[model samples]
Target: MSNSLEILQKYWNHDAFRTPQEEIIASVLAAKDTFGLMPTGGGKSITFQVPAMMMEGICLVISPLVALMKDQVENLQNKGIKAICLTGGISSDEIIDLLDNCEFGNYKFLYLSPERLQNDWILERIKNLPINLIAIDEAHCVSQWGNDFRPAYLKIVKLKEYFPKVPFLALTASATKRVQEDIVKLLQLDNPAVFTKSFARENLAYMVFNVEDKLHLMEQILKKNPQPSIIYVNNRKSCSETVTQLESLGFSATYYHGGLSPKDKENHMKLWMNEKVQTIVATNAFGMGIDKANVKTVIHLHIPPNLENYYQEAGRAGRNGEKAFAVLLTNPSDVIHVEAQFLSVLSDKAFLNLVYIKICNYFRIAYGEGIDEKFSFNINHFCTKYSLPILKVYNALQFLDRQGIINLSQEFTEKITLQFIIPSKEVIRYMSLNKQDEEVILTILRTSPGIYESQSVINISLIAKKSNTDENKVLAILHKLNEKGVIELHAKNNDATLTFNEVREDERTINRVAKYLEAQNKLKTDQLKSVLHYIKEEKKCKNKLLLSYFGEVINEDCGVCSYCISKNKTKTDTSTLSEKIIGLLKIQDLNSRDVVKLTKYSKDDVIFVLKNLLENDTIMVKPNNLYSLKN
Candidate 1:
């Protein structure tokens, strides 16, 4: 085998790199600042991994998600690459020790979250490592112009300042042209070449299902695409509730979200990755850096916040190059729910000032001085007490953070409730009269909030396991009873998640701030419009559209998109895919480039045939960076 093929076989055990991968790898190895606009499952990690293995020094990869960092490090170690990450769960002393290992130890890849970049000891920790390349995953987060702008990303500029000779490789599955430019400018890359691969997935069908009952809908979708799948819900409550429903239906599944204990999240995720579990019902927080290539489908329990989010979540399916499907389940009310959320974000300056005051009053302390005291907040209760809009209040809090008022650490807590308010006999009579509804009635009573003085902290799992029902049923039945006005629903200490801009702007400042907020609101609305555009785009192949969104322009169609497939069905008549391969290669080599080179045939035809050949072991990509006939 030739050098590239030997490296491929030795480490990744693949026949050859995907299209554009060779060029990308070559650029990075040559010490050029490289930007890769590859689609989901396009081997973006491999581009950096190969170069990291080839280079003599360590490659520092800055990622936003800790779970993604952990998974990638484990996967690399599994492949015999030395890798590690310094995340928050560890102590500072442990961090010092880990840094010791990295500095003198035989480690090639070191991953760190951008937040850690600002840590006082981090620069001290890595002041002397033989670092070579700096790979920034989720590069869009660096740009304020993108959907998830993280201020921590700005700290990455320190990399170039600290180590001027190190090359940079920024990789992201989804980004807009503006975000790509921002990443390049932010990272201070000196004239980087963006290698973009097509985003079209012919094997993964894009479809949506409208369902009133999400639990029933989840089971139906799971049964259809039974292979390992991911089900994304908007909240942690929904994630756990859906997992319970899936488990009740006898599908072994798990759940993950920012809400779960880190240990629980880690254990449950391992089960799915290890194939001990077949499904994971989770919030959008799950599934980054997940490289399980055989995921069959991804079901969105509700509409995603934006097309960028939806596309990234959906793209998780069919990664093994096999046929897969991605479906979205939407209810009409979902739009209203989302709109309500967005509108609530428009809290007036008074609400912000009021909440800021309450926050200060609650702490009996002002901002910049509460580092030692822990805060637990329920926006609903807080707003109710203050007669403020919860959504607007929430936005005020975020804006305050933007204004440098408070520190909102990433922490979540569970809420529990008691079921009925009536006496036992009265409840018995109600159940007796509605004998057919006993199970449903019992569910409402048991899962009902307020057992502790008619209210308990959130403990749906304990209730469900005891009552032999799932959280979804518990919630659904409770809603049914509440609809009939049988009992009231009261929650307490809701959603402990909090963020603080370092200082609260006083109420006296609102009239002066109104004009500025109006402009910010318009900017936010425009961002939402861009999100809608990503969703409604149907003209270009999905892959090409996604790549171009990241500012990488592929001159030819991917030939492997769903649109290409449907078109090929109507236009071409062939007995075998080999004939199609020959037709494609007649115009060019059978490399990933040749597959991408054709402007004539549908990309769906080219990719579908390529997959078939790979599966049957008919055609093989060999050494010397070329494809050839094999028997």
Candidate 2:
């Protein structure tokens, strides 16, 4: 068998391993359970991939993210390694065939979600495979104390019953001491060799600012950095609005969110990655599995839900070890806003049970039935019909999904099916009369043939593109045609796809996962409180605060952070600050805010110097409150 370094060189084309990766790989190869706590962008995949390449049999890799699993499997396949990922939407026959390939076709890696292990048939098939290593990615999900806890991850430990001697490798980028201990105990990792890389990012400067005008501050930051960067917002509307705002200010930018189509997401990411765009304005959905090394800055328009999320998102910058910045812009009201957004929407056990029963009833599923049944779900319509709060219901659905009761797919598309009632010649006459709708009608007719004979699904976006119009216009034209009896249009606004992963047991099904839901809600509340504290904190070093939260203690403060810089500014002599303010006033009359901006000093110091100057007549305040130098 090839050694780990030889395998890494042969496949990854890397000359040597990064720090701690070689050690983790050695432990895994020694047939011992291993746990690796590395920071984001720390090359965690190398430790498992290199050793798995040298192993004798196939490696069973369990991950919580379907997109991550697919991406990793594709990447390995591109490197001429045999790999397969089993996610939702695949048929049983397809799964059996894939497993057969893993067993007999010399496949090296079988990446699957933790929820898949709950399937008895899949588990039985997996038991027959010659597994070499059981690798768990995002292992923190197994811990209730972690920021993102998924109860389905607990099922991953059942694999140990089948492969008792097979070594397990659990890896995560963000996990505290409590979370690490939970991962070890819950995953049944037997006396695992743990490797932790310090969470301190030496080259990254953490900054927090309370600003009145966040957009203006963001623009100033972008101008100062002017390199590849990511601006994270909390919602889809903000992503698009921020991009438009940045573009109007003469900057190149694009937006990313879960609502965007896959093609659009990929295209936007490519534009940012290839330097065709200077920045990517995105929601939190944009950054998993992304490896861009030259990001000079990462700015958050609003505070994140937790420090773990903030650290991971901020750590995306300066991966190449050069100087970079992580900035958070917030105001006093943001505390209440964040709580309303994240905390208020948390669903309790009773709410989850209600949602579960209502959904099953809506779908007309009988009790103890409805396994593997899928439906197109419109959350707005469902909530309206049941008279429930949209945010709370959405949260409940997400919780059910995490518990493996249902597979919620938020990538939804509008389904439009239409059939023309009028003859082709009469349709021409109608279009001639309604000239404004002529192009959309013609485009739809040309793109969707046989519309007069039978109903057919049409792509509204495609029709809009072909006619050089927008989707809204096309939809309006279709509705007008339908109203005129020219066509029979059926349109359903589907924003998600729901698949029942388990039988409908109503309250019993919910009761089984009630403890987890309660714990998760409590965890979320605690995390939000921590986030608020971090934002309000002023005395501690920003980097040290973040590191300490992650269970790492460091003596020295990161001198580049906002707190350190402010602390240094307070040490400057008052006379020196007054001299700088006088020099600025001599150039031109300026206000206190502008003086602070120009001098790069703390606001209090600038204000203090301005007060002294005004009292001593060194500088005089004009009518408009602008300070001017005395002649």
Best TM-score among the predictions, by candidate number: 2
Top candidate when judged by lDDT against the true structure: 2
In model 1, what is the error at residue 225, expressed in angstroms?
Answer: 3.3
lDDT for each residue of candidate 1 in 1-631, tens digit (9 for 90 to 100)? 2455567779888988888888988888788999998877677778887877877889888887666788889888998888989865456688888888899888999998777777656786776889988888888777766666667688888878778878889888777777778889998888898876656676777654333455665776678777899988877767756776778898998888865667777899999988798898888778776778899988887767566677788989988879887776654345335555665677555666677778777666664454324466655455545566644666676655443245453444455444456666776787788665577556545654334233334454444555666667766766665566565655433356454323433564445455545555665666555544443443555556555555557766655554444545664443355675766655545554355454345444554565567558766555433455664
Worst 10 residues of 1 by lDDT: 449-458
Clashes of each: 33, 0
TM-score, one value per model: 0.66, 0.82
Clashes of 1: 33
- In model 2, what are the clashing residue pairs, if there are any? none
lDDT of 2: 0.87
Per-residue lDDT of 158 in model 2: 91
C-alpha root-mean-square deviation, each candidate: 15.1, 9.4
Error of 1 at 33 (Å): 1.0
